[model samples]
Target: MTTPAPEFNKKLGFINAFTAATLMGFVGFFARHIDAQGDFIAFSRMMCGAILFFGILAYKGRIKELLAYKLSIPMILSGFFMGNCLSAYITATQHTSIANAVFFIYIGPIISTLLAVIFLKEKMKPATWFALVAVFIGMMMISGLMSVGPNGLSFGMEFSQETFFGDMMGLYSGVGYGLFLFLGRYRTEVPGDVRAFWNFVFALAGITILFIFTKPTISQMTSTDWMWWIGIGIVCGFGALGTCTIATRHLKAAEFACVSYWECVVAALFVGLLFYGEPLSSGQMIGGALIIIGGMSEVVISMLGKSLKKTDKQADAMGAL
Candidate 1:
């Protein structure tokens, strides 16, 4: 198959990333009615999502590759870590503020960049470094560091014990997500669709096991609970598809990294509008703006860099002629 032109690929990638963001916006709506058993909700959502995704693959005759099941250990590890991250995050929210939870969760790119620098031996661009710094500042603000000004300082700064726990969980989730991203990059032998399918499958299986050990029963769940589960499946599952479509088709590893950060922005707006029934706080609004700006900065800079190199090459060709 012929590869698409670079410009076309970039456009396609942006579109895919945007679609993922839009789809993920609905997750907050579903999350609001989710009762006490957040982990159970997560398990149900992952299982249903896996079933829905695998069903599509099977219908499309992609089941052959799946049946061959050449499972990559890294991919499976990524899924396991991701599943654990989900459970941790949900558990954390039970103890912490959502603001703290989400602020720390958005730290994925920073963690991923750190990991890439270490394990992957990847060199980040100047813009990427700047973006990371921006994100850190944004996170500090989101975590309510700014609330400690004027009359001395509030020792807790706006973070409750629950918020701290939530932040911790979010931090681990970011690490797992980073690992997932890293593995997805290197596991080139696995087809994108197949890898995504298995990631969900493994996550579902792991969470299911966790649920079993916890002795979770759906008998206690209301119809609203079921509705949220279905919504989660639709939002996160199809959101993953949208992400894969763009990342696989058009984005380089770095570009994909940048695009994925939009998930945080989308999630914040969604949760605010749906649950809080209030506009995002000034801090959240500002922080989200910076995050989005910083996230896209890398992609924009990379595109410009690529364009400049192409122009230089063409000039050299003309000089030779």
Candidate 2:
């Protein structure tokens, strides 16, 4: 298949990333309402996602891509990182508020941006930097970090015994997901479906290995649980990751990381609209707006800049003529 033009590919990536992130937000619903532990939640998502991806690949007659996929340190680590982050984030939601969990998880972009600079040797535009700052502040507001905590600093993050473990898990998820994004850059040459297939397979494998060591007893899964679990797997796991593959393929990790905040904003919305009882304040509303604006602002600015530059060049050419 012929590659798309660089400019068009970037736009396509951005749009798909936005959609994927929005779809990913629904996982919070399952995380919040499901009675299962984080292990089970993660296991179900990865397992079902892998099956679905495999089936699709087989149907599309692209299963050879899966077999042709070479496992390297980067590939293995990327999948493992995804497994770690998904499990940790779900675990955080099991104990803490969804907003707080999302806030912590969104920090992955920060780490991803940094890794992009160091290893990927990528640079961000001034507009992107501004959007990132705006989104991050908004995330903090949504997470209630606007309130004063034990520290005089504005971090507003305070830990209690009940939420300490969950909060830590969220924070670690940020790190794991950061690595996942950075590693995704390596798999861009592969087909989007193939990339997603490997991601689910490796993530499921990692989680399974973890379960082997720390065996947890299973609880009875109601029919409702089964339905929700499969739905989450298809939507948030297969759908989200498939779209994410398209995004990461065309855009650098840092370039798309800021826009990924759409996930947090959408997740917050689900909490507000669905579970209205989740602790909320006016600050959350403002934060949600900021995140949406920040996510879009970069794209607008980039397009506008290109237009202006083209116009200027045209004017100069006409004057010369």
Q: In TM-score terms, which candidate is top?
A: 2
Consecutive 10-residue window with the lowest summed lDDT within model 2: 147-156
Question: Worst 10-residue stretch by lDDT in candidate 1?
Answer: 153-162
Q: For model 2, how does the per-residue alpha-carbon lDDT over 44-161 read when each residue is reduced to its tens digit?
A: 7787778988898789888777777567888788888888898888778777765567777888888888888888788788878888898888778766776433664255566678
Candidate 1 global TM-score: 0.80
Candidate 2 TM-score to native = 0.85
For 92-192, candidate 1 gives per-residue lDDT tens digits of 66667665555555565556566667886777777777876765655555445433345743323355553565667767776766665565555554555
Query: How does each model score on TM-score?
Result: 0.80, 0.85
Can you list the residue pairs that collide in candidate 1? 95-162, 96-162, 96-163
For model 2, how big is the CA root-mean-square deviation? 4.0
The backbone clash count of each candidate, in order, is 3, 0
